[model samples]
Target: MVQRLGSIGKLLVGVWLAGVTVATFVVIPPYQGLGDAGRIVIVHVPTAWVAVIAFTVSAVYSALFLRRRRPDDDAKATAAAEGGLIFTLLSTLTGMVFSQIAWGVFWNWDPRQVTILILLLIYAALFALRSAIDEPERRRRLAAVYSLFAFVTMPFLMFVAPRMAESTLHPNCAFIKGSDCNGITLQVGNVGLLGDQKVQLLGLERQGDIVVAQVKVSTPGLASEAILRPGYDLTTRSYTDRPTFPGQRFTLALESVNLERGEARINMEAPGSGLLANQRTLWVFLASNIGFTMLFVWMFLVRSQVLSLEVQIAQRKVALA
Candidate 1:
């Protein structure tokens, strides 16, 4: 019965993974809006997440195997490592596809991609090392030690090594929103696309060169009238803001901002040149922040209700030991 249950568990995991693969290709938003580039996210994110989980699971099993010298631990570790390598390979491949689209080249020496590839190489080495050792007891011991060492080195390679060099691919840990290391440039970049690194511009696409909306926004507290700018010009079909059109998306710059009323007034020289929006940034930001904050609060409150005791017990156990 136990063996049967294990078989069922394996079947379930297989089915779930197959479902994820199907969902990525089969169920997606409008391709023209996001284009073929968006497909990269489905495969890329899941495989990378699974790869990390696999490495973590392998580490746990290795620790258990080392403690108990059990054959089961070795088997589990081998399974995890194998799965981890496969997922890592998938991540690397999908990422390369995205890179080819965003960058002119197939492979750019981006720190994030390089680090992921290096991780793959290290895991591959671990497998080779495991095979080289023939004695059963010695093989398990060596494999556990190697896995532990590789796992430790991963942080250094993925986080430390990448930052130590120049990168164009993923956002640095320093640029991550709400991160402690976020600099002034990161904050500015978050506000303005031009202020961001060149790579940030790669992701945006210009749908049309027409002014979508125009509004005379009047704030109750300060401004009498605020011109809400459009991302593109309507009449000329060219960018209202000159020199912004040679790229994927136009950067909308406006007149002086009114901080007191919390608004910016856009002044367009041409009336026929359309630059308007149906949905304003302020509305988008407000909705996003409210939703995000509520989610955080909900997660915290729920976890506090049920998980607080478990957390407290775990802390106490740590303290006692």
Candidate 2:
């Protein structure tokens, strides 16, 4: 059964990889701001997604190990975590490349960057703790418990911390709202885009010489005639401000911020059209994420099998003794 599963996994992964490659290169449209460089998103986004998914799977298996005291469950948890760490490193490296292009720095202390670093350290410590322990049973139990505890940081580090931060060069949907990260919320009557009273602009997109933006803003007690002003243009992106004018034109600046009442300003860039507007890019990104996820599963299964084999060998040695 294990051999058959492995063969099937390998076959599926091959298909997934081929599809991702074609979609990323041949099918997807170039991003507005990043252009051909935006193709990196297909890889970078999927790597990060797989890392998080692996961590989630690890946590689930850890919980199962604690409840059932099964050796297979323990092996599965460790394997998933190992895969997660590997992809986390890839995600960070790819992000650095993207950062160098977007922000002109390889290692800026961006909020998302800092949080992901913290997450990597936490997982590295998990492995270190496992290695320091001598007894197999005790180590497995402790590791399972530690994995559960560490799982709490995953959501906060990857999602919550970045959002609560002051400012970031990273995209907004890196944590929440997903595809909606680059869009503005237009208040219809009372409810917000997130079904709340408040709204925030995720980011902005620009086209050629003209800056195009659509914001749906409604702040109770704030003026109905809120204006968006374009601030500094750093030659790469542009920022907008909430001036009194409704229809204003501006050039594409690197970090143009549009200041809103009681809200921190969001940096705007013309990353081409929105990802949603371009169906091909959207499908390519989606396919890439799914492909990487399948790769994660394959790695996890292979790692678990190796661990399980080692466990069996140890059992046989004990019997001989």
CA-only RMSD, every prediction: 16.2, 10.6
Give the per-residue lDDT of model 2 (tens digit) for 128-178.
999999898899999999999899999999889988865454743322211
Displacement of residue 125 (Cα, Å) in model 2 is 0.7
Show model 1 residue runs off by greater than 4 Å. 2-26, 31-34, 159-166, 171-321
Q: Identify the leading candidate in terms of lDDT.
A: 2
Q: lDDT for model 1, on a 0 to 1 scale?
A: 0.51
Q: Estimate each model's TM-score.
A: 0.53, 0.72
- For each candidate, the alpha-carbon lDDT, in order, equals 0.51, 0.68
Steric overlap count per candidate? 7, 23
